[model samples]
Target: MNKIVAIMAGSVWKVLVQPGDLVEEGRDVIILESMKMEIPITADFSGTVKEVKVNEGDFVNEEELLIEME
Candidate 1:
């Protein structure tokens, strides 16, 4: 199984992937905004995106699970 981890502490600005989307390692799956800057959440492994755990504009902490893969 693969997991996508949040890159920073921020509000989720957008979700770039949906369930069943094929994601490559180091791909940006979500965008977050913090301190007026945008950060991209990236996948650590290549796999099909199994789930998106957060919605647009949702607040997320550092290291949160943004997506699951398998």
Candidate 2:
């Protein structure tokens, strides 16, 4: 299984990919708002998204699972 996680604690500003979306390495999956700035979270491996584990405006802690893919 492949997964994407939050790199820092922040509110989700955007979810760029959805379940069943084909993702490439280095694609931004989530954009988090922390300290008034948007931080994009990227995928390190190519995969198909299997689950969306968070919603826009949801707060996530550092290392929190954001998406599941395989």
Candidate 3:
């Protein structure tokens, strides 16, 4: 399993991929808004998305798991 994690503490602005979606390394999987700036969270490994761990508007902390792929 591959885990995609948040880089900063912020509110989840958008989820770009869904379950069963094919993802490549470095592809943006989620967008986070913090201090009025948009931060894109990308996949660290290429795989098919297995689960989305958070929803839009949810607050997340640094190092939090955002997506799970396999």
Which candidate has the top score in lDDT?
A: 2
For 1-70, candidate 1 gives per-residue lDDT tens digits of: 6677777789999899999998888888899999999987777778998989999999988878888899
Top candidate, metric TM-score: 2
Model-by-model lDDT, in order? 0.87, 0.95, 0.94
Question: Which ten-residue region of model 1 has the weakest summed lDDT?
Answer: 1-10
Given candidate 1, what's the lDDT at residue 50?
90
TM-score of each: 0.91, 0.98, 0.96
By lDDT: ranked, best first? 2, 3, 1
lDDT tens readout by residue for model 2, 1-70: 9778999999999999988899999999999999999999999999999999999999999999999999
What candidate 1 gets wrong by more than 4 Å, as runs, is: none
- Location of the lowest summed lDDT over 10 successive residues in candidate 2: 1-10
Q: Which scores better on TM-score, 1 or 3?
A: 3
On lDDT, who's better, 2 or 3?
2
Tens digits of per-residue lDDT, candidate 3, 4-68, equal 88999999999999999999888899999999999999887899999999999999999999988
What C-alpha lDDT does candidate 2 achieve relative to the native structure?
0.95
After superposing candidate 2, which stretches have Cα over 4 Å from the reference? none
User: In model 3, where is the ten-residue run with the lowest total lDDT?
Assistant: 38-47
